[model samples]
Target: MMVDGVVARLRELDGELAPGDGVAVFNGMYLAVTEEVRDRLAGGRFDDPAAVAELDVLFAGRYLAAVAADQAGRRPAACWRPLFTARRQPGVHPVQFALAGISAHVEHDLPLAVVDTCRSRRCPPQQLSADYHRINDVLADLEARVREQLMPGPDPLEAADPLTHLVGCWSLDRARDAAWASAQALWALHRLPPAYAALATALDESVGAVCRRLLTPLVRRRSGGGQDQGGQDQLECSGLPSA
Candidate 1:
Protein backbone atom coordinates (compact mmCIF):
# COMPACT_ATOMS: atom_id res chain seq x y z
CA MET A 1 0.00 0.00 0.00
CA MET A 2 1.30 3.42 -0.88
CA VAL A 3 1.53 6.13 1.77
CA ASP A 4 -1.14 7.96 -0.21
CA GLY A 5 -3.50 5.07 0.46
CA VAL A 6 -2.86 5.43 4.17
CA VAL A 7 -3.54 9.16 3.94
CA ALA A 8 -6.79 8.49 2.09
CA ARG A 9 -8.00 6.02 4.70
CA LEU A 10 -7.16 8.43 7.50
CA ARG A 11 -8.96 11.23 5.69
CA GLU A 12 -12.02 9.03 5.37
CA LEU A 13 -11.83 8.28 9.07
CA ASP A 14 -11.51 11.97 9.91
CA GLY A 15 -14.58 12.67 7.82
CA GLU A 16 -16.59 9.89 9.42
CA LEU A 17 -15.82 10.76 13.04
CA ALA A 18 -17.15 13.70 15.03
CA PRO A 19 -14.80 16.58 15.66
CA GLY A 20 -14.41 15.86 19.37
CA ASP A 21 -14.07 12.08 19.06
CA GLY A 22 -10.78 10.87 20.50
CA VAL A 23 -10.05 8.57 17.60
CA ALA A 24 -10.85 11.38 15.20
CA VAL A 25 -8.48 13.67 17.05
CA PHE A 26 -5.69 11.17 16.78
CA ASN A 27 -6.58 10.28 13.23
CA GLY A 28 -6.55 13.92 12.22
CA MET A 29 -3.08 14.38 13.71
CA TYR A 30 -1.87 11.20 12.05
CA LEU A 31 -3.31 12.23 8.69
CA ALA A 32 -1.41 15.48 8.81
CA VAL A 33 1.83 13.70 9.63
CA THR A 34 1.25 11.13 6.89
CA GLU A 35 0.58 13.87 4.38
CA GLU A 36 3.82 15.54 5.31
CA VAL A 37 5.65 12.25 4.90
CA ARG A 38 4.02 11.63 1.54
CA ASP A 39 5.10 15.06 0.36
CA ARG A 40 8.65 14.52 1.61
CA LEU A 41 8.86 11.16 -0.12
CA ALA A 42 7.61 12.66 -3.34
CA GLY A 43 10.22 15.38 -2.97
CA GLY A 44 13.10 12.88 -2.54
CA ARG A 45 13.87 13.69 1.09
CA PHE A 46 14.47 10.08 2.10
CA ASP A 47 17.58 8.15 1.17
CA ASP A 48 15.53 5.12 0.08
CA PRO A 49 11.98 6.28 -0.44
CA ALA A 50 10.72 2.87 -1.49
CA ALA A 51 11.80 1.17 1.71
CA VAL A 52 10.39 4.01 3.79
CA ALA A 53 7.16 3.86 1.84
CA GLU A 54 6.87 0.15 2.45
CA LEU A 55 7.51 0.66 6.15
CA ASP A 56 4.95 3.45 6.28
CA VAL A 57 2.29 1.21 4.79
CA LEU A 58 3.04 -1.63 7.16
CA PHE A 59 3.15 0.72 10.16
CA ALA A 60 -0.19 2.29 9.24
CA GLY A 61 -1.74 -1.06 8.35
CA ARG A 62 -1.56 -2.11 11.98
CA TYR A 63 -3.57 0.92 13.13
CA LEU A 64 -6.08 0.56 10.32
CA ALA A 65 -6.49 -3.11 11.16
CA ALA A 66 -7.26 -2.17 14.74
CA VAL A 67 -9.83 0.34 13.52
CA ALA A 68 -11.43 -2.28 11.30
CA ALA A 69 -11.56 -4.78 14.13
CA ASP A 70 -13.17 -2.30 16.50
CA GLN A 71 -15.69 -1.24 13.83
CA ALA A 72 -16.51 -4.92 13.29
CA GLY A 73 -17.19 -5.30 17.03
CA ARG A 74 -14.04 -7.28 17.59
CA ARG A 75 -11.29 -6.32 19.96
CA PRO A 76 -8.72 -3.97 18.55
CA ALA A 77 -5.06 -4.68 19.21
CA ALA A 78 -4.54 -4.23 22.96
CA CYS A 79 -2.20 -1.35 22.29
CA TRP A 80 -5.02 0.47 20.52
CA ARG A 81 -7.79 -0.31 23.00
CA PRO A 82 -7.15 2.63 25.30
CA LEU A 83 -7.81 5.32 22.71
CA PHE A 84 -10.81 3.54 21.23
CA THR A 85 -12.26 2.91 24.70
CA ALA A 86 -11.76 6.53 25.65
CA ARG A 87 -13.03 7.82 22.32
CA ARG A 88 -16.38 8.95 23.63
CA GLN A 89 -15.35 9.65 27.19
CA PRO A 90 -16.14 13.18 28.33
CA GLY A 91 -12.80 14.02 29.91
CA VAL A 92 -9.84 13.14 27.72
CA HIS A 93 -8.00 16.08 26.21
CA PRO A 94 -7.23 15.98 22.53
CA VAL A 95 -3.53 16.05 23.37
CA GLN A 96 -3.99 13.01 25.58
CA PHE A 97 -5.79 11.12 22.83
CA ALA A 98 -3.17 12.05 20.28
CA LEU A 99 -0.31 11.05 22.58
CA ALA A 100 -1.92 7.76 23.53
CA GLY A 101 -2.34 6.89 19.88
CA ILE A 102 1.25 7.84 19.33
CA SER A 103 2.25 5.57 22.19
CA ALA A 104 0.30 2.64 20.77
CA HIS A 105 1.60 3.16 17.27
CA VAL A 106 5.22 3.87 18.09
CA GLU A 107 5.86 1.48 20.97
CA HIS A 108 3.95 -1.51 19.67
CA ASP A 109 3.19 -1.20 15.95
CA LEU A 110 6.47 0.32 14.89
CA PRO A 111 8.72 -2.60 15.86
CA LEU A 112 6.41 -5.09 14.26
CA ALA A 113 6.20 -2.97 11.14
CA VAL A 114 9.96 -2.68 11.00
CA VAL A 115 10.36 -6.42 11.32
CA ASP A 116 7.69 -7.06 8.72
CA THR A 117 9.31 -4.63 6.33
CA CYS A 118 12.66 -6.35 6.83
CA ARG A 119 11.25 -9.80 6.21
CA SER A 120 9.33 -8.66 3.13
CA ARG A 121 12.29 -6.77 1.75
CA ARG A 122 14.84 -9.44 2.74
CA CYS A 123 17.03 -6.88 4.39
CA PRO A 124 18.43 -6.33 7.89
CA PRO A 125 16.84 -3.89 10.34
CA GLN A 126 20.04 -1.87 10.20
CA GLN A 127 19.47 -1.16 6.52
CA LEU A 128 16.19 0.55 7.38
CA SER A 129 17.49 2.50 10.38
CA ALA A 130 18.37 5.70 8.56
CA ASP A 131 14.99 6.06 6.89
CA TYR A 132 13.27 5.03 10.08
CA HIS A 133 14.99 7.83 11.96
CA ARG A 134 14.07 10.25 9.22
CA ILE A 135 10.43 9.38 9.71
CA ASN A 136 10.87 9.83 13.43
CA ASP A 137 11.99 13.33 12.66
CA VAL A 138 8.53 14.03 11.33
CA LEU A 139 6.82 12.48 14.36
CA ALA A 140 9.03 14.52 16.66
CA ASP A 141 7.83 17.64 14.96
CA LEU A 142 4.23 16.54 15.36
CA GLU A 143 4.69 15.99 19.09
CA ALA A 144 5.96 19.51 19.60
CA ARG A 145 3.20 21.02 17.52
CA VAL A 146 0.56 18.96 19.31
CA ARG A 147 1.72 20.21 22.70
CA GLU A 148 1.58 23.76 21.51
CA GLN A 149 -1.81 23.54 19.83
CA LEU A 150 -3.69 21.51 22.44
CA MET A 151 -2.08 22.85 25.61
CA PRO A 152 -1.08 26.24 24.40
CA GLY A 153 -2.32 28.04 27.47
CA PRO A 154 -0.12 28.92 30.45
CA ASP A 155 3.18 27.04 30.78
CA PRO A 156 1.92 23.63 31.86
CA LEU A 157 5.07 22.67 33.69
CA GLU A 158 5.54 26.02 35.38
CA ALA A 159 1.93 26.19 36.52
CA ALA A 160 2.26 22.76 38.16
CA ASP A 161 -0.67 21.58 36.08
CA PRO A 162 -1.95 18.00 36.07
CA LEU A 163 -1.81 17.92 32.32
CA THR A 164 1.89 18.46 32.88
CA HIS A 165 2.02 14.93 34.23
CA LEU A 166 -0.06 13.31 31.49
CA VAL A 167 1.80 14.73 28.52
CA GLY A 168 5.14 14.83 30.29
CA CYS A 169 5.24 11.08 30.82
CA TRP A 170 5.24 10.25 27.11
CA SER A 171 8.57 10.60 25.31
CA LEU A 172 8.61 10.09 21.57
CA ASP A 173 12.38 9.82 21.52
CA ARG A 174 12.34 7.03 24.07
CA ALA A 175 9.47 5.33 22.33
CA ARG A 176 11.27 5.41 18.99
CA ASP A 177 14.51 4.16 20.51
CA ALA A 178 12.70 1.30 22.22
CA ALA A 179 10.85 0.57 18.99
CA TRP A 180 14.15 0.22 17.12
CA ALA A 181 15.40 -2.14 19.80
CA SER A 182 12.20 -4.14 19.59
CA ALA A 183 12.51 -4.37 15.83
CA GLN A 184 15.97 -5.78 16.24
CA ALA A 185 14.65 -8.28 18.74
CA LEU A 186 11.78 -9.26 16.50
CA TRP A 187 14.13 -9.71 13.57
CA ALA A 188 16.41 -11.87 15.65
CA LEU A 189 13.48 -14.11 16.55
CA HIS A 190 12.34 -14.60 12.96
CA ARG A 191 12.88 -18.35 13.10
CA LEU A 192 11.27 -18.67 16.53
CA PRO A 193 7.60 -18.26 15.85
CA PRO A 194 6.37 -18.91 19.39
CA ALA A 195 8.85 -16.50 20.93
CA TYR A 196 8.14 -13.86 18.36
CA ALA A 197 4.41 -14.17 19.00
CA ALA A 198 4.91 -13.93 22.74
CA LEU A 199 7.01 -10.80 22.45
CA ALA A 200 4.46 -9.25 20.16
CA THR A 201 1.63 -9.95 22.57
CA ALA A 202 3.58 -8.60 25.49
CA LEU A 203 4.38 -5.47 23.54
CA ASP A 204 0.75 -4.92 22.63
CA GLU A 205 -0.47 -5.25 26.21
CA SER A 206 2.30 -3.15 27.71
CA VAL A 207 1.76 -0.31 25.29
CA GLY A 208 -1.92 -0.36 26.16
CA ALA A 209 -0.99 0.11 29.80
CA VAL A 210 1.20 3.05 28.90
CA CYS A 211 -1.59 4.66 26.93
CA ARG A 212 -3.96 4.17 29.84
CA ARG A 213 -1.58 6.23 31.93
CA LEU A 214 -1.30 8.93 29.30
CA LEU A 215 -5.06 9.41 28.92
CA THR A 216 -5.65 9.52 32.65
CA PRO A 217 -6.57 13.20 32.93
CA LEU A 218 -5.83 16.54 31.30
CA VAL A 219 -7.06 19.41 33.45
CA ARG A 220 -6.19 20.50 36.98
CA ARG A 221 -8.62 21.84 39.55
CA ARG A 222 -8.85 25.54 40.01
CA SER A 223 -8.29 27.20 43.39
CA GLY A 224 -12.03 27.77 43.76
CA GLY A 225 -12.89 24.53 41.96
CA GLY A 226 -14.57 26.41 39.13
CA GLN A 227 -14.17 24.66 35.77
CA ASP A 228 -13.38 26.42 32.55
CA GLN A 229 -12.30 25.26 29.11
CA GLY A 230 -8.58 24.60 29.29
CA GLY A 231 -8.84 25.72 32.91
CA GLN A 232 -7.16 24.13 35.93
CA ASP A 233 -8.84 21.19 37.48
CA GLN A 234 -6.92 17.74 40.02
CA LEU A 235 -6.25 16.87 36.36
CA GLU A 236 -9.63 15.21 35.93
CA CYS A 237 -10.75 14.74 32.32
CA SER A 238 -12.13 18.28 32.63
CA GLY A 239 -15.56 16.73 33.12
CA LEU A 240 -14.63 13.10 33.73
CA PRO A 241 -13.01 11.33 36.67
CA SER A 242 -9.35 11.92 37.35
CA ALA A 243 -8.84 8.23 37.94
Candidate 2:
Protein backbone atom coordinates (compact mmCIF):
# COMPACT_ATOMS: atom_id res chain seq x y z
CA MET A 1 0.00 0.00 0.00
CA MET A 2 1.03 3.61 -0.51
CA VAL A 3 1.99 5.86 2.39
CA ASP A 4 -1.25 7.79 2.26
CA GLY A 5 -3.28 4.59 2.28
CA VAL A 6 -1.30 3.28 5.24
CA VAL A 7 -1.86 6.48 7.18
CA ALA A 8 -5.56 6.37 6.43
CA ARG A 9 -5.89 2.79 7.68
CA LEU A 10 -4.08 3.69 10.88
CA ARG A 11 -6.25 6.71 11.39
CA GLU A 12 -9.34 4.57 10.96
CA LEU A 13 -7.97 2.21 13.60
CA ASP A 14 -7.28 5.10 15.92
CA GLY A 15 -10.87 6.17 15.61
CA GLU A 16 -12.35 2.67 15.97
CA LEU A 17 -10.58 1.46 19.08
CA ALA A 18 -10.54 2.83 22.57
CA PRO A 19 -7.73 5.28 23.24
CA GLY A 20 -6.09 3.05 25.84
CA ASP A 21 -6.73 -0.27 24.17
CA GLY A 22 -3.52 -2.24 23.76
CA VAL A 23 -3.54 -2.32 19.94
CA ALA A 24 -4.75 1.25 19.81
CA VAL A 25 -1.84 2.33 21.98
CA PHE A 26 0.65 0.93 19.49
CA ASN A 27 -1.37 2.10 16.51
CA GLY A 28 -1.26 5.67 17.73
CA MET A 29 2.49 5.57 18.19
CA TYR A 30 3.01 3.98 14.80
CA LEU A 31 0.77 6.56 13.14
CA ALA A 32 2.91 9.33 14.51
CA VAL A 33 6.10 7.59 13.43
CA THR A 34 4.85 7.09 9.87
CA GLU A 35 3.70 10.67 9.62
CA GLU A 36 7.12 11.85 10.70
CA VAL A 37 8.80 9.73 8.04
CA ARG A 38 6.43 11.13 5.46
CA ASP A 39 7.37 14.63 6.56
CA ARG A 40 11.07 13.80 6.29
CA LEU A 41 10.61 12.43 2.79
CA ALA A 42 8.91 15.61 1.66
CA GLY A 43 11.64 17.71 3.29
CA GLY A 44 14.43 15.86 1.43
CA ARG A 45 15.93 14.57 4.63
CA PHE A 46 17.42 11.49 2.98
CA ASP A 47 19.72 11.09 -0.02
CA ASP A 48 17.33 8.59 -1.62
CA PRO A 49 13.75 9.51 -0.89
CA ALA A 50 12.34 6.83 -3.14
CA ALA A 51 14.23 4.08 -1.36
CA VAL A 52 13.21 5.45 2.00
CA ALA A 53 9.59 5.61 0.94
CA GLU A 54 9.66 2.05 -0.33
CA LEU A 55 11.18 0.82 2.92
CA ASP A 56 8.69 2.77 5.00
CA VAL A 57 5.66 1.48 3.12
CA LEU A 58 6.94 -2.07 3.15
CA PHE A 59 7.64 -1.84 6.89
CA ALA A 60 4.16 -0.56 7.61
CA GLY A 61 2.63 -3.16 5.32
CA ARG A 62 3.99 -5.99 7.44
CA TYR A 63 2.10 -4.55 10.41
CA LEU A 64 -1.09 -4.00 8.46
CA ALA A 65 -0.95 -7.45 6.96
CA ALA A 66 -0.56 -9.01 10.38
CA VAL A 67 -3.60 -7.16 11.63
CA ALA A 68 -5.61 -8.32 8.67
CA ALA A 69 -4.50 -11.90 9.10
CA ASP A 70 -5.36 -11.92 12.78
CA GLN A 71 -8.79 -10.50 12.06
CA ALA A 72 -9.34 -13.09 9.35
CA GLY A 73 -8.65 -15.87 11.89
CA ARG A 74 -5.19 -16.54 10.56
CA ARG A 75 -2.16 -16.43 12.79
CA PRO A 76 0.30 -13.64 12.16
CA ALA A 77 4.05 -14.00 12.35
CA ALA A 78 5.30 -15.54 15.59
CA CYS A 79 6.65 -12.14 16.59
CA TRP A 80 3.19 -10.64 16.33
CA ARG A 81 1.52 -13.47 18.21
CA PRO A 82 2.02 -11.91 21.62
CA LEU A 83 0.35 -8.59 20.90
CA PHE A 84 -2.54 -10.27 19.14
CA THR A 85 -3.00 -12.69 22.02
CA ALA A 86 -2.57 -10.31 24.95
CA ARG A 87 -4.00 -7.19 23.41
CA ARG A 88 -7.27 -7.58 25.28
CA GLN A 89 -5.93 -9.14 28.43
CA PRO A 90 -7.00 -7.47 31.67
CA GLY A 91 -3.64 -7.01 33.34
CA VAL A 92 -1.43 -5.63 30.61
CA HIS A 93 -0.86 -1.87 30.68
CA PRO A 94 -1.36 0.09 27.47
CA VAL A 95 2.25 1.18 27.52
CA GLN A 96 3.41 -2.38 27.81
CA PHE A 97 1.22 -3.33 24.90
CA ALA A 98 2.62 -0.52 22.81
CA LEU A 99 6.16 -1.45 23.70
CA ALA A 100 5.51 -5.06 22.89
CA GLY A 101 4.25 -4.12 19.41
CA ILE A 102 7.30 -1.94 18.87
CA SER A 103 9.54 -4.79 19.93
CA ALA A 104 8.06 -7.22 17.43
CA HIS A 105 8.09 -4.70 14.60
CA VAL A 106 11.66 -3.58 15.13
CA GLU A 107 13.21 -6.88 16.06
CA HIS A 108 11.51 -9.29 13.68
CA ASP A 109 9.68 -7.48 10.92
CA LEU A 110 12.39 -4.89 10.24
CA PRO A 111 15.10 -7.30 9.14
CA LEU A 112 12.63 -9.09 6.92
CA ALA A 113 11.38 -5.79 5.61
CA VAL A 114 14.96 -4.90 4.77
CA VAL A 115 15.34 -8.04 2.75
CA ASP A 116 12.06 -7.46 0.96
CA THR A 117 12.96 -3.91 0.10
CA CYS A 118 16.35 -4.98 -1.22
CA ARG A 119 14.70 -7.55 -3.46
CA SER A 120 12.23 -4.99 -4.73
CA ARG A 121 14.93 -2.42 -5.35
CA ARG A 122 17.49 -4.95 -6.64
CA CYS A 123 20.11 -3.68 -4.22
CA PRO A 124 22.16 -5.05 -1.32
CA PRO A 125 21.35 -4.50 2.35
CA GLN A 126 24.30 -2.11 2.73
CA GLN A 127 22.69 0.21 0.23
CA LEU A 128 19.73 0.57 2.57
CA SER A 129 21.63 0.77 5.84
CA ALA A 130 21.52 4.53 5.95
CA ASP A 131 17.79 4.60 5.39
CA TYR A 132 17.32 1.82 7.91
CA HIS A 133 19.11 3.83 10.56
CA ARG A 134 17.15 6.92 9.61
CA ILE A 135 13.91 5.02 10.26
CA ASN A 136 15.38 3.81 13.52
CA ASP A 137 15.96 7.39 14.55
CA VAL A 138 12.30 8.13 13.96
CA LEU A 139 11.19 5.12 15.99
CA ALA A 140 13.54 6.06 18.82
CA ASP A 141 11.99 9.50 19.03
CA LEU A 142 8.50 8.00 19.20
CA GLU A 143 9.64 5.49 21.79
CA ALA A 144 10.61 8.26 24.13
CA ARG A 145 7.26 9.93 23.67
CA VAL A 146 5.37 6.68 24.31
CA ARG A 147 7.32 6.18 27.51
CA GLU A 148 6.62 9.66 28.73
CA GLN A 149 2.92 9.54 27.94
CA LEU A 150 2.14 6.07 29.27
CA MET A 151 4.49 5.68 32.20
CA PRO A 152 3.14 6.27 35.66
CA GLY A 153 3.83 9.55 37.40
CA PRO A 154 6.46 10.00 40.08
CA ASP A 155 5.86 8.26 43.35
CA PRO A 156 7.95 7.43 46.41
CA LEU A 157 8.75 3.93 45.14
CA GLU A 158 8.58 4.76 41.48
CA ALA A 159 12.11 3.52 40.91
CA ALA A 160 11.05 0.14 42.26
CA ASP A 161 7.68 0.15 40.59
CA PRO A 162 6.77 -2.89 38.55
CA LEU A 163 5.88 -0.87 35.49
CA THR A 164 9.18 0.92 35.72
CA HIS A 165 10.94 -2.41 36.02
CA LEU A 166 9.14 -3.73 32.95
CA VAL A 167 9.99 -0.70 30.83
CA GLY A 168 13.62 -0.77 31.93
CA CYS A 169 14.02 -4.39 30.87
CA TRP A 170 13.33 -3.67 27.20
CA SER A 171 15.60 -1.31 25.23
CA LEU A 172 14.81 0.12 21.80
CA ASP A 173 18.49 0.91 21.25
CA ARG A 174 19.36 -2.73 21.71
CA ALA A 175 16.55 -3.84 19.40
CA ARG A 176 17.66 -1.45 16.68
CA ASP A 177 21.23 -2.66 16.94
CA ALA A 178 20.10 -6.24 16.72
CA ALA A 179 17.96 -5.47 13.66
CA TRP A 180 20.95 -4.05 11.82
CA ALA A 181 22.88 -7.20 12.59
CA SER A 182 20.02 -9.39 11.41
CA ALA A 183 19.72 -7.46 8.17
CA GLN A 184 23.40 -7.95 7.47
CA ALA A 185 23.18 -11.61 8.35
CA LEU A 186 20.22 -12.07 6.05
CA TRP A 187 22.08 -10.33 3.31
CA ALA A 188 24.89 -12.85 3.66
CA LEU A 189 22.46 -15.77 3.66
CA HIS A 190 20.64 -14.55 0.59
CA ARG A 191 22.38 -17.06 -1.64
CA LEU A 192 21.83 -19.93 0.79
CA PRO A 193 18.14 -20.66 0.72
CA PRO A 194 18.08 -23.31 3.46
CA ALA A 195 20.27 -21.28 5.80
CA TYR A 196 18.23 -18.18 5.19
CA ALA A 197 15.03 -20.00 6.09
CA ALA A 198 16.54 -21.36 9.29
CA LEU A 199 17.79 -17.99 10.44
CA ALA A 200 14.52 -16.29 9.62
CA THR A 201 12.54 -18.80 11.65
CA ALA A 202 14.91 -18.47 14.56
CA LEU A 203 14.71 -14.69 14.45
CA ASP A 204 10.93 -14.74 14.44
CA GLU A 205 10.68 -17.05 17.45
CA SER A 206 13.30 -15.22 19.49
CA VAL A 207 11.69 -11.84 18.92
CA GLY A 208 8.26 -13.25 19.76
CA ALA A 209 9.53 -14.50 23.10
CA VAL A 210 10.89 -11.06 23.91
CA CYS A 211 7.55 -9.47 23.03
CA ARG A 212 5.67 -11.96 25.21
CA ARG A 213 7.84 -11.14 28.20
CA LEU A 214 7.36 -7.43 27.62
CA LEU A 215 3.59 -7.86 27.72
CA THR A 216 3.51 -9.76 31.00
CA PRO A 217 0.94 -8.56 33.48
CA LEU A 218 2.31 -6.16 36.06
CA VAL A 219 -0.62 -5.68 38.35
CA ARG A 220 -0.23 -3.11 41.08
CA ARG A 221 -2.31 -4.09 44.10
CA ARG A 222 -5.99 -3.24 44.09
CA SER A 223 -9.12 -3.74 46.26
CA GLY A 224 -11.65 -3.78 43.49
CA GLY A 225 -13.11 -6.67 41.55
CA GLY A 226 -12.28 -5.56 37.97
CA GLN A 227 -9.78 -4.09 35.57
CA ASP A 228 -9.09 -0.35 35.29
CA GLN A 229 -9.12 1.95 32.31
CA GLY A 230 -5.87 0.64 30.88
CA GLY A 231 -7.08 -2.94 31.42
CA GLN A 232 -4.92 -3.39 34.53
CA ASP A 233 -6.44 -5.48 37.27
CA GLN A 234 -6.28 -3.84 40.68
CA LEU A 235 -7.75 -4.80 44.01
CA GLU A 236 -6.90 -1.67 45.98
CA CYS A 237 -6.81 0.77 43.08
CA SER A 238 -3.27 1.76 44.10
CA GLY A 239 0.18 0.30 44.64
CA LEU A 240 -0.66 -1.45 47.91
CA PRO A 241 -1.75 -5.06 47.64
CA SER A 242 -5.28 -6.13 48.40
CA ALA A 243 -6.21 -6.42 52.05
lDDT agreement with native, every candidate:
0.86, 0.83
Which residue ranges in model 2 land beyond 4 Å of their true spot? Answer: 154-160, 222-243
Tell me the deviation in Å of residue 204 in model 2: 0.8
Cα distance off (Å), candidate 2, residue 176: 0.5
RMSD of 2: 5.8
Pairs that collide, model 1: 219-235, 220-232, 220-233, 221-233, 221-234
For model 2, residues 12-95, the per-residue Cα lDDT tens digits are 989987765788889999999999998999998897899888888888888999889988999998888888887777767778
Q: List the candidate 1 regions with Cα displacement exceeding 4 Å.
A: 152-160, 218-243
Q: What's the distance in Å from true for residue 77, model 1?
A: 0.5
Q: Pick the candidate with the highest lDDT.
A: 1
Say which candidate scores most in TM-score: 1
Lowest lDDT 10-residue stretch of candidate 2: 234-243
